[model samples]
Target: MGFFDRIFGRRSAGIDDPEQLRRQLFDAAARGDLSRLAGLCRANRQAVETHFPAWQKVPEHLRSDPAAMQSHVQVLVAIAQVFAQQLGDASLFQRLMGTPRDNPLMRWQDALRQAQERIDALEFTAARELLTGVLSEAEGLQGSGVDELLPITLGRIGECHFESGEAEQALPYMQQALALCEQAGDADGVRIYLGNLFEVHRWLEQREPAAACARRLAEMIADPTAKRQRLRQAERVAAGEPRNRVLAVIDGASYELDELPPLAAGHVRFMFERDRITLRRATAANEAGEACGGEGEYAEALAHFERAATADRHDPHCRYQAAFTLLHLRRYAEAESAYAEVERLAPGWFHCRADRWLAGRLAAGDVEHDVFLAVHALQDGPMAPDEKLDLAEKTLTRAPRLALLHLLRGTQLARLGREAEAVAAFRDGLAGDGEPDVRSRLLVELATHCDGPQERAALLRDAQAPAGNLVAAATAQLLARGSAN
Candidate 1:
């Protein structure tokens, strides 16, 4: 079972047969039976899994029948309520909304929406050109009502201005659209406008106003209609619990908490830690991401990691994480950049070594280089026990025999109130074969990780050499040879 399944329910939430479910889903959408649509959705969200096996995979339900597929497309757009619930899966929505060029209507809609998405991506000039084309065509469609064209056109214009660093200019258009959307009672439209307005306020350093908008947004996310994790995260921030902990309990419970407003300093530090700022606050929001990684919460970990990468301007660590996450997420090409970044950063890290080891196993072009990048994203200063534990898990899996690895692992485990495991790792390293210098260091580490002076003294004695000891026989022979030479 998936983590969400275990946390929420089962995968087969019982709307079997994709064709049958597709028909039912679309029929309900046509009838405006929101409760029925939600019932179907609630029963089978992973149904999207049946449709799109992965992000890149073809959707099965769409291929079953043309009418069903058209219905599926309409249901996707028509039922605003359903879209709200599925907001958490924006990429899925993007893919579902993506139709072939032969389907002119769907294609036009997709092109227009994609133009807006490009704007969100901060490709202002490109986005504006695309929007200009879209709006020109949309305007030619005389029957396209003011309600249909105005908000989208104005919103796109404001977005372009905002992306071009004109927050002041962006504000009025977004605000005006927001008021119109509110008056029209179009929840989704209001959300889009509010989202733009929030960005404008944030850019202008209007914290109080931004905070108020952010707070209202948080409330909107609380509506079941806005079941998006990112929106929920924003809501959590507005609700005053910013440093929230999303713990994937070992038993598969993804525990999310609300706490305090996030420190923008930490957010900034994390974003620019590698070099540039990421678009999102994944690094800032989920500082405990590594901890989740150690416990096989790779999916959730990937979520935060990818968000961070997508938000940034090609950070090596973020890219590396994205690649690794995609690898674990079973997306090979998607993860290629991440793996490539890893090689770029560390050239000597274990994954690179593994690539070298598997070179013969891979195709020639695939094995272009043996080098990998070294990306250490740990905090610059001291790390907490839990943090250390996370690092040890990630590192030791690759560098298991490094004495320092074991020492740090033991130290972290002990700190996390796991003294027994810590002591065992320490003793196991100390007792294993090693040179005298290494033995001395291991003794010191054991002393640090272990409790009581007696254990420390015992370790010290084992590390000590006899008082009457002289140079080793091999060194003596080498000295004699040197003299002879």
Candidate 2:
């Protein structure tokens, strides 16, 4: 019932209960909470003596279990030793774990401190010798509390190599350290080491891996501003500048092109690969491509679009618009190939090319050319009036505010001899706030389907002002109608 009674296994079946207390101490140590851990160690001081022997009795196989109270107490003691070393007290580990200060654990603790001092003194050779010795011992102590020392030792060895300008040699050790840090659930360690890894990858000219690190950090970090900043930074790394300066790997670091190895030089001939990132970026050249294509500079537009496509291979808009430009350039085969790739990537980039071309052809003379977008295709000429009317109605479902579509609908109905329906379609076109030119055309058409002479004349009067050709056409129609009456 009491804490000590539960910890000493008085009930034997209650061995699992003290594990909760051990876990609390381990958690505090992992969090770098020295004060909290110190308080816990003091409170559980008596429990440690009994738990140490219980831990020693564990089967070697059972010792590997992280939640075993045996390993928890051991790791907790290791953490306390680290604090004691930092605070310049030699008795903390022995006092906490009820052990003499002459054990293998104590030797490793002392070695760790000497290695740090050597590293700070720039004696990398001595530092590495010391750290690696501890690393070997830690690795052999697997399944014990010594598992917690693996990343720490590995990380320091990595730093020695890195600071000595041997990043390539440091790479494997640093990577292992990062993995162990993550496994230990040390958030601060992970965040710090990720940045270090990102820099090393970049220094090695490993853009994809570097971008991967940046992207992962951006997602895991809690700061909202930093997330967006890192995502943008990730994309830039992913979409690295064209023909970036490739460096040569030297004594564990990067060097200039002049020093490139033959194998690395050959690598330059390989096509630059693109990194596929999730965040979308606006390809500035995409807008330039559109403007150039609209101005009839098809070749220039194709080049601009190609630049954007190369910059971001996964951007569907750039790829799709490139295909559109190729078609304008009359490179049909290239256009088809680009479209096929776009289709393979996923097909949401929408441009109503066929509809805009068909509408332009139909309104060839003196009509203000306004581009309209529609999901349904209005077939190239020779379509029957009734078929066209059906297509126009379908297009209106997706683009109800497209006044040009309304005008087209009225024209088709008039051809189909639906007088009243034609009039109503034209009225809808004007009511929808069509451009002045389209509205003028609608008024003239509406008058043709009006039932009475006065209604026809009234509609034509409104049509005569805006469009130059509409004025002549309307005046002539009015005179002819009056004579017929």
Candidate 3:
């Protein structure tokens, strides 16, 4: 059956004597059919006047005044309430008395309240139908409170459309509501409408419009804390766009970061910083051709790193990492050049001098002393004892004066369960004429491997004398604490 027919039919079945005049009046009032109610009241005027004192004045009020129609509905509701009590049926009473008032503003509020309930129950179709009728009735209203009720009604209609996945259709209603709210100087209403517009535009993928709404929302908010929240929200919306698009959005608004409130300006500054970092990292990754060193795509990785270095010329870390990657690829001359640029940008930020020395050795075609293979291999996976031994042997042959290589060899031997060979390797490495940094590092390694307390103490003491390497001094202090205990 049709919707209203089914509703009336079910309600009519409950009343055994449906032909009763009071039952007909109750049904018309319950359905909110003002025309049918007026007709029924006119036809039964003598009975209504005699039975319901309050309703006797309604016919005269309706004929004399256009604004008196609300009072007429109230009288009908009173009559319905009496009939409901007599018949012991509260459904008619509920329908007629739900709104509790008969003014146009209250009627609109009642409709909105009912619509909200329907929405909460996931009855979108029923909510939409109710909101549509409310919208029509609200538009016809022309009284003091109409101005206040109309915008609210419009906004709610927009919400109905939005919640029902018709955001495109919601756009115009929200925009009209926003304009009305602005004209009425209703700040809260304006914010609500603007929020609706922003969400709708975002759902439609209209990025610029959504960002504009967010910006307007931020500007309209008066409270500092609330303004900051809106500004952050705007920044997040803008951040989803491409770099150029974000820049365009900021520039189009003609707002300098410094011109905003302190919290808003802080958010803008953070966005700019985040964008710079993201762009730099992305450029580096794209140029490198693979995420981590390009997985043997050394030439492409080098090209990407070089492009990254050029893209972010002021960032020393980018240049440094690029140089490191080049060293892995054994492009020693290019690695030397990149490391030199890093030193120029951030002097003494890393062990650049030592790195340059190694690069120079590789450039001379001396593969025996190359540490990149062992280092890169370690990055790949854990090394076997024989692999570490082979690397150590090759490193020792080409760079016997490199004390760190001896320490590495001794550490590898110790890990292989060959403590005697490890001890011998550490002693041999200690005899090398290396720099103070290398000597201190070797001493710390030997002290860690040594079992004899006196020997360990002597090695730590030698390492502790080095003022340049804080790590060795710290290691000695820690080892001394253990000995004392």
Candidate 4:
């Protein structure tokens, strides 16, 4: 019928039913009726010897002696183990043996190990039953020295519920375990329970409680670097709602950071500073792009928006602005590519799908613009200077109205050592209604090659009127030079 039945046979070893024999042995041993147990074993001597050869060597007098019942319990436990392993029915074994007292802690550990095995097999009900029974026994021994085992048993019972996807059911058990651990001053146990509570509350989407648990766990961490990292994570999870709560979390994290070891403190501080700089740069570029777009300076807006996107690709709004500005500038292919990225990053945004469609339609019909072609060629750093100049000139011929094309031609001409041609091209682009930042950049370039003091001063002053890092630096240098003279 079953694997065990096939191996042992239905009525082998002279026992008609192994299950009935197991029960009689348990009853006799539990009642301290060694006389009855010996009688039964003697009647089923062949069955006992066949299943357990060691039992044949046990002296007959010891079998009926109450003083030697501890040995009798061991034999019974061994028999129960055999049935549990062969029949895969541990209920009778667990009920009959409970936890052996020959070596109480070792017996408890064995029971826990068996329960874990049952859990691993997805036999959650069996695991829970075993853990509950063990917990009852452990609690009963509270007045004994075994009181320390109660928290561990309670935690195991909670683990059974947690593994079974009954987090709500697991909560009270974990809380009780935590209380006992606290009462016992078990630091490791407290850390473990807090960590478990954090996971449970997070899975339940109870953010506030989860955050509280996270904060407690962070406080329990002993390693300086690990503690700082955990505190940072706790700060993030605790973020939201009333300003006071958020501030409290941040302050707590900051306090922990101050307590970090010197080397770890320096490393974390460097990381924080780098992140802050990156965020500030991205924000400034995004804001500058918005300002330029508001003033209808699409070319300058596109430059700043691209910078913003490069600095922080996670900012969907920056990517979208770059795409929109490219659309206004009639760079359809670039706009389409940018919109595709926006769609990927923010699929559910209200305008993403519509904007993607519009960009796709525009890009399908429009020819590649000369400005885009020239910029692409210049981006190929290995291209010869003459080839770049040719590309720039071709761009100017096709889109004579685009000021950036003129600037491109000027820069390429300057690189080719044609200062006169570069100056003329820069002035031509400066005359058109391009972005102020672009105009300032052109003036700075032109001023660098100017020979006359008056002309250089004028170019620097004009460049200083616009806001840009390069323009500001160039203007300040020239002004300081003039003052020195």
Candidate 5:
């Protein structure tokens, strides 16, 4: 017998399916059938599992998660009210749901991840709604152990607003996040929030506060030359002078914050159009990027790369370099987009998939700066492969644990005529859950390498997915060639 069965000695919950129970309970309540709802609860006092009633269907992760636990307690209170007189026990619900204060953090994780994907699609409004809901939940955890989550949550909401061209709306949240960071003595957090505040304030013509933020940033992140450079921007903002390197007209209403330019000296000039500044033609060499960035001139290096990539959307190198430079500058949020674009432009680009993975982690504030830097610094260096084997080896070692990377590795090895190693790579990539399209492609590739007709058919079957139009077409073409099921 289960724990609940033992506790109540075969008292029938009578409800096997939680979904049907939920429907019946809600229906009963809607029609003012209080007695029936109470009757249902009393009948379900001892389930086979300890979950007793509707709680049985909840995943173990949700049942154990701290944030969900708190919500569960709230649910217990309402249930107790419904069954209070019938069950004659107020503490019974507490025993079922556990003690609760508030913990909104863990409950917000899945929503935040989904929101990041939405943000990646430039669906700012939808992403903002998701983030704002989480932020509202954060209020319930004010004195709880998870209050540390508040600053970052607030900052993300601010970023959503900032990216959607709502500076005034972003200001208060940014300021609050910064203040929380200050209170928490998070120096790095303070530096980041201050940089963001400087961007918003200067754009909003709140120049005095912008100057203050700039000066603070200089104290935090500047080298000697960069120190003087930041001081100059601070001075300009303080004096309400026209901001430097902003090549757009200052009409206030239509002004957009493009890439954050350098504080003092800059390499390339950008022509900011009405909505955004698109990169025009720039003939600067890649070596020039390395040189300029050597002195921690990341802003200028970023500008150089963006310009080089403007009309050359097909060139993955420029976009990858720009993303790397943004990472170096600690502009993680922007780097996420840059790296994502590179991933789309060239999925097989040199370390693009791996770095894009890191960029997401960094943007979500999930990875430490030093950790991200260490991983980034160890990139597969300039894609100069002497042979396909070398390229495959490098890709497997340096790329993210993504099926697409392994697929590339496998394809490269196959081209080099290394059949055994190629098959191994394909199998390794398919070992975990992955993007359906990439997984389908990897499975299709593996199918072609199999010796037996049955094995080949099975692999092809595994590769075929509902959304994989390309893979489905490829599979059909292969099947026509007599590798049939």
Candidate 6:
């Protein structure tokens, strides 16, 4: 069929084949037909790019053109959907932005802009797919354009974490992206990430860093019309110095203590609650602990964190880390105490305390720990529902990296009759590349559901059997149960 024939429903010639095929491919994409989309892109790769182009740069003046607006909107929506579904091939979408035929569209500025829109809408799955594709392509691209995509990708990663409620984990990526923008002399990008950096610091309860970011942002906003140049000129501005002023919540935004911005009473209360935490000031001992930890002084860091915890029993972060550090040091008693304190003070911030506690119990070589492990070893065995919930919540909050956490928490939840939450947790767990220990643990956890030989095979396949023999034995028992069933 000819092009016009396809449009007019006359299939006399083969000329309309490409157009018909393209429409079908798009429809398939809309329905999440991944296999079909992959086949279509493979067969009509050139046609796809020709229709979309390497860079669909919609000029600002085209805003009034309804057709142009519609076209952009449709393509963007489709692209975003593909990313969300985690579809197989996106070569065609990348080609629209001028990527080489063999290379996917990882660093196209136009695509990045659209991806940013999806992020703003809280469509993180789509955002991540888009960013991941961009990063993959970027690994091979040696051009300055790759640099342009770097900060944006980092910012998107931060957004993904933030949307999942892992605000603490989001801080580093935002700061990293801002740093890249500064290095690249991308003034606009710098300004954008600066605002993001500010928000991340606020979320982290790092008042000093947030204040600094805000001050820098104020200095950057010289002339609204000169935004581009203003960004470039940002390097010349003096870095913000820490001020003694400590405002709780002036306006809706977190600000210094001295100046109160005009904010509604309700907003003020919300902001105050979010921003205020009563952790004691970090002393010299605390600094030493952090310094030691950063320098790979594990032993020294453990000591310092313990000392800091000892100095202030009320600090949850300190207590939690001290507990974990003690685990690494094989100090079971101290670790248990620290973990118990954390549970008492901040029950909301759960991150594998039960498992850690179990590890502690086993390490002590006590009969009680052995008995607990033995009971938990059975296939589809009962576990505390509360612990599973805590694990799921923690996994969700820290997604796209802690896959093992997702797997463990999801499996436990599945065993406890929370199927929906279990599915969500497993999906998130599959989202990221987890560490080897986490991966092994997850695999073992998954073995509990597999029947017969497969379960035994999975246990044998574990690359790192967790340092504790009891955990290893429990894993083996679970596999045996799966086999028997």
Which candidate number has the best TM-score? 3
What TM-score does candidate 6 get on C-alpha atoms?
Answer: 0.28
Whole-model Cα lDDT of every candidate shown, in order? 0.52, 0.61, 0.63, 0.62, 0.62, 0.55
lDDT of 2 by residue, 105-211 (tens): 66677788899888766577789988887666655454444655677777778777765556688789879889888988887778877877786676555788888
Worst 10 residues of 1 by lDDT: 267-276
In model 1, the runs with Cα more than 4 Å from the true position are 1-124, 132-144, 158-170, 203-205, 218-404, 407-421, 424-485
lDDT of 4 by residue, 1-485 (tens): 67744445333234567557766765766676554555556567556545443332345676456446565556567555545664454543555544577445556766788987886665666888987876666553322235466677777778777665677898898998899889878898999999888766655556677789877887787897677677665665566322111011131343222333222213121111110112334577889999998888988988888887765544466778888788778877787788778656544232444355546655875324444545545644467788888887776676575555677788888998999999899888877545454566677777776688788877776766523323233343444354336
Model 6: weakest 10-residue lDDT segment is 269-278
* TM-score, per-candidate, Cα-based: 0.33, 0.35, 0.38, 0.32, 0.33, 0.28
Candidate with the larger lDDT of 4 and 6: 4
How much does candidate 3 score in TM-score?
A: 0.38
What is candidate 1's local distance difference test score? 0.52
- The local distance difference test score of model 5 is 0.62
Off by over 4 Å in 4: 1-107, 120-123, 143-145, 223-225, 240-485
Q: Model 2 misses residue 140 by how many Å?
A: 2.8
Residue-wise lDDT of candidate 1 within 1-485, one digit each (tens)? 67775544333346768778776766877897666666566677677445542323325755556565555556665433454554344544555545645333454566667876776555677877766666565552322244555676678777776656566888876886788688778899988887777767755656556666765776777655344444554444444431111121223222232222222222111011111122333344244456666566878877767665544433345555555555445455556555656555433232332322223222333322211111122222267778767776676566455444565567667777787898887776665434343344456556655667666556555544321011111122222233334
Candidate 3 per-residue lDDT, tens place, 1-485, comes to 56754432322222233237665775677676644555555455456545554333345535546466665565566555544543344554555444536545677878889988886765666887898887776664554466777777777777777665566788888898899989988989888888878877766657778888989988987898668766875776666632211111132242323343222222221111211122233244454545656466666676676665544444555666677777877678988887777556554334454465557667887544246566345334467877877877776777777655676788778888888888888888778755455566678877887889998888888886632244455456556655766
Show model 5 residue runs off by greater than 4 Å. 1-103, 142-145, 243-485
Q: Which ten residues in a row have the lowest lDDT in candidate 2?
A: 270-279
Tell me the alpha-carbon RMSD of every candidate: 23.5, 23.4, 17.5, 16.4, 26.7, 24.7
